[model samples]
Target chain A: MKNRVRYTFILPALILMTIIVAFPIIYNLYMSLHIWFVASGSGPHWNGLKNYIALLSDKRFWNSIRVTIIFTVGALGSEVLIGVLLALFFNRQFKGKDIIKTIFLFPIAATPVAVALIWGMMYNYDLGIINVLLKAIGLPPLLWLADPKWVIPALIITDAWQWTPLILLIVLSNLESLPTDPFESAKVDGANSLQVILYITLPMVKPAIIVAAMIRSIDAIKTFDLIYVMTQGGPDIASENLNLYIFNMGFSYFRMGMASTLAIVLFTIVMAVNVFLAVIRNRDVT
Target chain B: MSKSYIKTGLFYIGIAAITILPLIVFLWMFLTGLKTQMDNLAIPPKIIFSPTLQNFKSVFAQNNFLKYLFNSFIVAVFAVAISLLFGLPAAYAIARFKMHKIGLTLLIARMIPFISYLIPWFIIFRKLRLVDTYIALITTHLIITLPFIIWIMVNFFENVPISLEEAARIDGCSYFQVFVRILIPVVRNGIFTSSVLGFIFSWNQFLFSLILSGNRTMTVPVAVFKFISYEEINWGGLAAAATTITLPPLILTLFIQKHMIKGLTSGAVKG
Candidate 1:
């Protein structure tokens, strides 16, 4: 009776998950193995490995992979570095600390689409605040989202602005929980603050940093709303990542099979990275 | 002593700078929302200007934004409420039974790219003639809210002392009775935290809504695009709409600031 009741307790949620979560994933896999286009008014026909074959040679697919890599590396790198630094700076007691921390939470809390819209306006060329500020500071304003060279960087800046705080919050919480003995011993050894931070604080918080990075990477690689709203993978598709590309294939073009293939690839990449990081985290623990 | 004082002063300045830097975009959005179109488009960008409610007026009066706001609210409420309903029991079972595999399954579901699900859902909903319905929107949004609620509440339920359950059992209380009359009251704060966070997430979700919801179920995030057209963009109206859409989550987060961090980090750190 006791054993059966536990399953009963979990039944509703498990049923809902299987229907909503598990079913769709299986359906997506099924779709990926077939050729179908909604616009053609034709049902799915089995065309195993062909969609995958086309994806292997598709130039646009490769471009999207490249763009995703650059965006992920750039955004995640800056976020982790700046976030860790901010966490360190904020570790000490200070005046108005809670208020300051609350202010930091605003970006994380705000709607992503709305956040993208505001950044879109700020990145405007002629009369945007960014350019106006640039001119005020005796610098020439350059095209931001319009220029291919600048689009990824501009997107990265906006991403960093909104998401860096997540890393900071995670790392800061880890830092607070850290043991004091190591730091006190390091101090007794006459190590400078920078040395202590470099050798002691950083190495100690390695697990938290890895976890933070893993979370950020997963979210960043699948970023769509910000890219779609701001650029629509435009300015010559310079900023189009896998998510946007898959969106175009599935929805805009109605190429369901191709889109499913792309999506499967993205899913594989995300899961691979997740497993890789979990391995590193486990290795560190043992 | 003077040198240390200067250092402290610089430290404060540094913290202030970093905090204010990101906030400037929001501040700019708010100020622009209050500006007249002429003032908004002015050269040198008017740092000081007589404000107007015209943008806000136009957003509601001209664009029918109230409908979208209603849609967003209804979807988020129903989604979070249902998640709580299903998630609470599952969370309790997972916590007490040490069902870590079920917990991991939910976590993987959360981690999957939403677009993968969107394709299959779009097709399925289209076949059922359920596209653009509240049912479709609410159901699709479960993918976001349900997993989150279970994860957070599982953590919350684990923290509850089992002795309390034993006490209730000894008093002839059944399992359901103990769970309801005893456990629910203890973790009411967890329920609040998960619900608020879950509501905010479902509220902010854009892609699923973008794909599944049509004109009848248009959400606030998708509605923000109405201010943009092919020829020109309504800067003031866009800002006004963006600012309005951002406020609910922003304000709710402020109320649960401490709990939000605990909720977010608990999954990653402890999982």
Candidate 2:
């Protein structure tokens, strides 16, 4: 009786998950094996591996993959770097520190669509504030979202602005919880601040930093709203990440089978990164 | 000593810049919402202007923004409420019984792209004639809120003393009764944190609602796009709409910052 009761406790959630999460994933797999276009008004018919073969040769698909890799690496690299530097700066006591921390939390919590929209306006060529500031500094105002060359970097800046705070918060929390004995000993040994940080602080915070990077990487690869709202994968598909490509395939083109295949590929990529990071984290522990 | 003072002054200046720099976009958004179109489009970007409530008035008067706001509220509330109901007991069971597989399953479910789920959900709901209904939106949002609630609550449940449950059991309290009378009260803070976080996730959710919901159930995030068209974009109206949409989550996050940080970093740091 005791053993069975716990199962009952989980039953409702299990059932809900099966209906909502499990069923969709299975159905997506099944759909990926078919050739169906909803716009054609014909139901799905099995065409095993054709969609996959087509995807293998799809140049647009490959471009999206490239874009995704660049976005992920660029955004995640910057976020971690900036986040760590900011966290180190903030770990010390200062005036209005708590208020500053609270302000940091606002960007992460703000709505993504709204954030994208605000950035879109600010990226405007003629009247936007970013270019205004650039002009004020005596630099040329580049076409931010309108130019293919500058689109990805522009998007990266927006993404970094919004999510860097998350990495900062995670690292800051870890920094606070660390033991003081190591720092005390390092000071007694007459080490400089940079040396102490490089030798002791960073190594101790490695696990937390890895975890933060992993979380940010997973979310960053799946970024959609910001791309969709700001550029809509425009300027000749310059900023179209895999997520946006999959969305266009499914909804705009109504090619459900192709869309499902793209989603599976994305799923595989995300899971691979997740497992890879988990393995590294586990290795650090042992 | 004089050099050290200079360093301290630079440090304060750097900290202030870091803190205030990122917030300029938000400040710009709020200020633009108060500007007339002429002021908004001014080349220098008007830093000082006679602010007007016209944009806010037009957002409500011209677009049916209040309805979208209501839709967002209703969907988020129902989704969070349902997630809490199913997630609390499941979290307790997983924590106490060492159900690690179940916990991992929930985490994987959370990590899957919302687009993957949106494909089948669009098909199923279309067939059921449930598109544009609250039922479809709330149910799909469970894919977000349920996993989030369970993941956060499991951490809270693990921290509770098993002795408390055992004592209740010895006192002739049934498992369900002990869960209700003892564990529920013990992890109320976790419950609050998860609910707030879940509600915010659902509220901010755009893709699911965008594909699944029609005009009748359009959310605030989706509604912001109405101010944009191919012909021309309504800058004042768009700014007002965006500002309105971001306000609730910003306010809620302010109240729960400490708990929210702990919740966000709990599993990531430990594992």
Candidate 3:
């Protein structure tokens, strides 16, 4: 009776989950294997694995994949590095720490679309304050969005700005919870501050860092709003990561079939990465 | 002693700069929202000027942003309410039954790109004539809120002592009764945190509202996009819209900074 009740308790969420998430995934797969553009007002025509095969050779698809990798790595790498450093700096007892820490939480929770708009204005070539500040320092103004070379970096910078706080928060929390025995022992063993951090603190916080990195990487690869609002994958699709490309394929062009195929591919990549991270994380935990 | 004092002073300055760097952009945006178009674009940018309410007036009056704000509120609130109705029991079950697979499933749902669900949802919603309805917007917003609420509340439920519920069950109370009478009372803080975070996520959601919703149910984030066009950009209006959109989440984060941080970092710590 108790077991039955437990299963019953889970059933509602299961039903909603199936309807909201699982059903769409299956339907997304079904759409991917057919020609089902919504505007056509016709039923889907079955097309086996042809869509997947075609995506293999699609230059734009490959370009999006490449962009996703660069963007994810660039943003995730910098965020982890800078976040850890900031966490270290903030671990100390200091005046005004409470106020500064509270303020630091602002960007992590702010609306992404709004943040993107703010960044877009700040990156505008002629009217932006960034260029104004640059010229004040006797530097030439560069086009932030109009140039292909700068677009990915610009996006990465914005993402890092917003999310580095998350990494810092996680790391700082882990740092606070770390056992003090090792550090105390190390101090008595005549260890310097740098050596203690490298040997003792870093190892203790490795799991937190990895968790933070994986989370940031997943979120970074799926970034859409900031790109959609800031650049819309412009300058010849230079910053067209997989999410925006799939979005354009579905909504802008209404190529539902191709878009669904690409979305499935993106989903597979994300799930695979997630599974890999989970395996590693579980092993570390055990 | 003097050298160490100088070092501490330098560290404070560094921390202050690091803290302010990300926020300077937002500060600029807020200030720009209060400036006229000319003043916004003025060379060297205006350091000090008489702030104006013109941009806020234009966004609210011309863009029907207040309607969008209402739409956002409706979607976020209903979705979160529905999520709690469904998610609390599931989280309780998962926490008590060691249903790790179910938890993993919800995590995957949380991580799936919003686009993967978009095309199918758009098609289905269109077929049902649900497009542009708050029903469509609220249902899809559940995709974000449900998983988050379940995930956060699962951890919270785990921390609740099993003895309390066991005692309630032994007293001839039904499982549901125990859940309501004992678990809910004990986990009120968790429920509050989950609701606030869930509401914030739903309110800030962009992609679903962008693709699935139309003029009737546009959200604030999507509505702000109206200020930009191929022909011209309304910098002042856009900033004002952005500023307004950020206020609720900002204030929420400030009010519950500890819970928000703990909630956000829950997965990482337990990992």
Candidate 4:
């Protein structure tokens, strides 16, 4: 009876997870193996490994992979770099620190779709404040979202703006709880400020930095809403990452088979990245 | 010491400069939302302008902003509530019993890209004729909220000494009673933190609502997307709509900044 009751406690959550996550993942794999079209009256017919084979040769798929790499690296790299700098700065005692920290929390809380629209306005070619500020500073106005060359960078800037603060929060808190003994001893030994930071602080916070990096990387790979609202992978598909590519394939074009195939590929990439990070994290802990 | 104080002051100034620049973009959105159409498109960007509520007026009167806000609220509240209902016990069980498999499963659900679930959800909801209903949106949002609640709550549950529950059990408390009467009271703050985070996530959800919700049940984030479709894009109205969508979560963050940071970083430090 006791065991049955304990099982009941966990059963509801398990059922919901199975229905939502596990079932969909399995169904998606099944859909990827067949020719399924939303518009066609005919039901799906089995095609063994056909969709995957086609994806191997598709230029669009390759372009999306390339774009995903550029975006993931650009966005995650900057967020971590800037986040560490900000965290270091904030670690120092200062007046009104809490207020600034609170303000920094806003972007993470703001809705991404809304933030994207706000960015879309800021990047507007004709009447955008960005170009206006450029002109004021004696520089020529550059198309932000309009130019294909700049679209990916534009998305990266937006992502970095929102998420860099997350890394800041993580590292800042970690910095707070760090033991001060090493710093005190290093200071007693006549270590300079930069040397102390480079040798002492960096090593202490390395694990937190890595954890923050992996988390941000995972979330960054699945970016959709902001990209969807900002460019929709337009300007000749210059910014079409894998997530958006899968979305367009399934929803806009209604190619269920190809979309499912792309989704499975995306899933594998995400899982591999996660597993790679997990292994590193384990090594760090040990 | 005085030289170090000056250096610290400069550092604060620099931090403010870097942090405040991106915030200016948000400030500009709010300011532009109050500008007249011509004033919004003015050359050199209208830094000084008479603010007006006409944009907000139009966003509400011309567009159905309230309906979407209501829909988002309803979906978020119920999603958090249901997630807590199922997730709390599961978290407790995992924490007490070392149910590693269930815990890992929840983490996997959290880790996977949400896109993997979208297509199947679209098909299933459409077939059931449940598309655009609150029931459908709430059910779908559980995917985001459930795993989150379980994971965050697991940390808090582990923090509560098992000895407390053990003492309660010895005092003639049933497992359910020990959970309800003792454990829940102790973890009320965790519940609050997870609920707010879960609600914010659900409120900001765009993809599932984009595909699943129709005109009647569209959410604020998806509704804000409609302001830019193939027509004369209304800059003033779009800013107003965007601000409307942003303000709630922003306010929520301000009030719960401490808990929000704790909840967000709880998993990071341990990981």
Candidate 5:
């Protein structure tokens, strides 16, 4: 009787999860296997593995894969490194630490579309404050967005700007949670600041660093708003991420079949990476 | 020593500026929103330009912007409400049962791209004739928010001493009543944090709203995107529009950011 009563509540929750999350994921996988298109309103014609084959042959698909990698790796690597350093600084007892933290949190929670627009304006070559400051310092003004070489860097910079506060939050919280006895023991052992940090601090925070990296990497690969808002993957496909590329294929040109295939590839990559992380994370747990 | 202090000072200041640039730009957008088009785009970008409410008038008066705001409110509200309604029992079960697989599935949901499901959802919603309905948008939004609520509340529920809930169950109170009255009283802040974070995520979500919503259901981001359709975009109007849409989230974060960060980094870093 006791077990049966408990099972009732779990059943409803299970049904809701299946309807909302599980069903859609299954449907997405099924859709990836077909040749569906926009507004056709007609039922999909099954073309087993054709979508996958076409995706393999498509050069633009490969180009987008390359771009997606650069975007994800570039954004994740920089954000975590810079985020830890910032988190450490913020953790230090300093004047205005709270206020600086408040300021730091602003970009992380602010609407992405809006932040993208603000950065878009700031990156304006002529009227933007960045170029003006550079010219005032007697430096030559470079085209921030119009130039191909500078575009992805600009996107990565903006992403790091908004999201480093995220990793910083995680690291700073873990830093605060560290027991004080370790530092005291390290000091007794005649360790300097750098050695203590290298030995005690970094290892202690290794779990957090990995966790932060996984979370950031997950979203980094799917970054759509900032890329779309800032560059629209422009200056000759300089910053076309998988999400934005899939978006363009589906809606912009109405290639839903191809778009679904891209999504499948993206899903596979995310799962593969997530599996790798889970294994490492699981081992850490054990 | 003084030279090293100067170097450290320079480096710290540089990092601070980089971190603060987006906020400064946001302020500039707000200021520009209050200025005329010509002044907004002036070569020097006038800091002292004459302020005007013309853009606000156009935003509110012309764009039917209030409707979009209302839509955001409605979608975010119901979606968050529903996520809580369904997620509570599951989170409680997960916490109580130590159900790692269920928790892991929700975790993977967080990591999956929204586009992976978009293709099918658009099809299903369209076929159901539910496109442009708040119901369609909100329920679909649950994909993003439900997991968030469950994930955050898992910690909150875990934090509660089992004895309190167990004692209630042993008493005359039914399990449901214990959940409603006793357990809820303890986890109010957790509920608030999850609900608010969920609200913010649903409110700011773009791609779902893009395909799911028609003109009547258009969101702030989609509305902002439409301004660029013409060969010519009114720079002042666009900036003003962006500023208008950015304000609510900014103000929400300004107050609730501590919790927002807590929610963002919850399980990622084991603090």
Candidate 6:
């Protein structure tokens, strides 16, 4: 009876997780086996891996994968590099550290919707501040989301702006946690700031770096809000990511089976990245 | 001495500018919210516009703004509650037992691209006639909240030693008793952290609520999205609506700024 009751609390969560979380994941696989659309109506009709096969052949699918790679690498690269630098800069005790830390919290709590809106306005070609500033500086105004060439770069910048703080916060905490003995010894040896950081701090924070990289990469891979709001995978799907492609498939095109296939593919890719990280972490743990 | 001061001042300037750019833009939006459409659109950008309550008046008068607000509230609140209920015990299990695989899985669930599930779940919810319902909205919101709860709470629960619960057990408490009587108190910070993250994530969720919620159940994000469409973009109304939708979360963010910052990245970078 006691065991049963203990199970009660755990059971509800397990059941809910199974139903809500696990179910959609499982159902996506089931749906992916079909060649169905909105006309398939209530439940998707099975075509037994045809959708997956189609996804393999689809140019649109390949394009999305390429775009997703660019987005993932671009966003994660800046987030990690800039994040490490920002964390280091803020690590030293300084006046207004508390206030700066608080301000650094903006991108995290600033709703993606609002961030996208503000970015959208900033990226606007004509009346936006960016263009205005460019004009004032005697530089040519670049169309941020209009031209396909610059759209991805613009998104990368905005994404970096929003997420670097997240990585910075994480790495800063990790830096604070580092054993200071080595650093103190290094300082006693008259090592420079750059040498101390490069020699001691960097190596010590590897786990934190890995964790930050993993988390940021995951978030970057799944970016939907800023892209959806700012560009909607536009200027001819220049910014269409896997997530946006999935959104378009499901909502705009109503290709339920194809969308499920895309969703499952995205999930598989994310899992691969995660598994790779986990293996590295496990190796480190040993 | 002069060079050092110049460099220090430049560093401060750079940091401040980097941080303040978005704030200035957000302030512009807030200021636009307080301006008449004509004042808002003026060229040379009347950095000082004649403020008016007219936009707020029309926004509330025109849209079912409160209903949308209530929808956001309902979804955010219940989603937090449900995610906590589902997440806490699992988090507790992961913390005490070190169930690494399960923990990883939960994190992955939280991090998974949400848009992937939008249509698949939409069809299922429609089949069950649960689409656009509060149940659907709140449940769908679990996609955002539960993983956050699990991730945040796991770190908190991990920091708490199991010996306290062992003491409760030796005092003749059941496992549930230990959880209810002991673990909850020690992990209150974790609970608060998870709640804030959950609430914010739910509040910010767009794709699910957009497709899932019908006319009666529209959310602030989608409602803001509605202000711009094919026929004609209502630039003034859109900006006003964006500002209005953004204010509550921004205010809420400031109110809980400390917790919000700690909550967002603390788990991933444990000391």
Q: Which prediction has the highest DockQ against the true structure?
A: 1
Off by over 4 Å in 3: B267-271
The digit string of per-residue lDDT tens for model 4 on B84-139 reads 99999989888877787777777677767787888888888878999999988998
True contacts kept of each: 0.80, 0.77, 0.81, 0.73, 0.64, 0.46
RMSD of each: 1.1, 1.2, 1.5, 1.5, 2.6, 2.6
Candidate 6 per-residue C-alpha lDDT over A57-172 given as tens digits, one digit per residue, 9 for 90 to 100:
88888889999999999989988999998888778766787777777776666667767876777677766777878888899999989999999989998898888887888888
Off by over 4 Å in 2: B1-3, B267-271
lDDT of 3 at B214: 87
My TM-score estimates for the predictions, one after another, are 0.98, 0.98, 0.97, 0.97, 0.93, 0.92
- Candidates 1 onward: DockQ, in order: 0.83, 0.79, 0.76, 0.73, 0.59, 0.51
Task: Report the poorest 10 consecutive residues by lDDT, candidate 1 chain B.
Answer: B225-234
The residue pairs found clashing in candidate 5 are: none
TM-score of model 3 vs. true structure: 0.97
Write out the backbone clash pairs for model 6: none
| CAPRI quality level assigned to candidate 2 from its DockQ score | medium
Candidate 4, which segments miss by more than 4 Å at Cα?
B1-5, B230-232, B267-271
Using TM-score as the yardstick, the better of models 3 and 5 is 3
Q: Which digits, one per residue and each the tens of the lDDT, describe model 2 over residues B87-180?
A: 9999999899989888888768866888999999998898899999999999999999998888889999999999999999999999999999
Worst 10 residues of 3 chain B by lDDT: B225-234
- Looking at model 2, residue B184 earns an lDDT score of 97
- The backbone clash count of each candidate, in order, is 0, 0, 0, 0, 0, 0
lDDT of 1 by residue, B142-161 (tens): 99899989999999999999
lDDT of 6 at B65: 78
When candidate 3 is compared with the true two-chain complex, its DockQ is 0.76
Cα lDDT of model 6 by residue, B102-141, tens digit = 6666666765668665766788788799887888888889
TM-score of chain B of each: 0.97, 0.96, 0.95, 0.95, 0.90, 0.90
Worst 10 contiguous positions by lDDT, candidate 5 chain A: A1-10
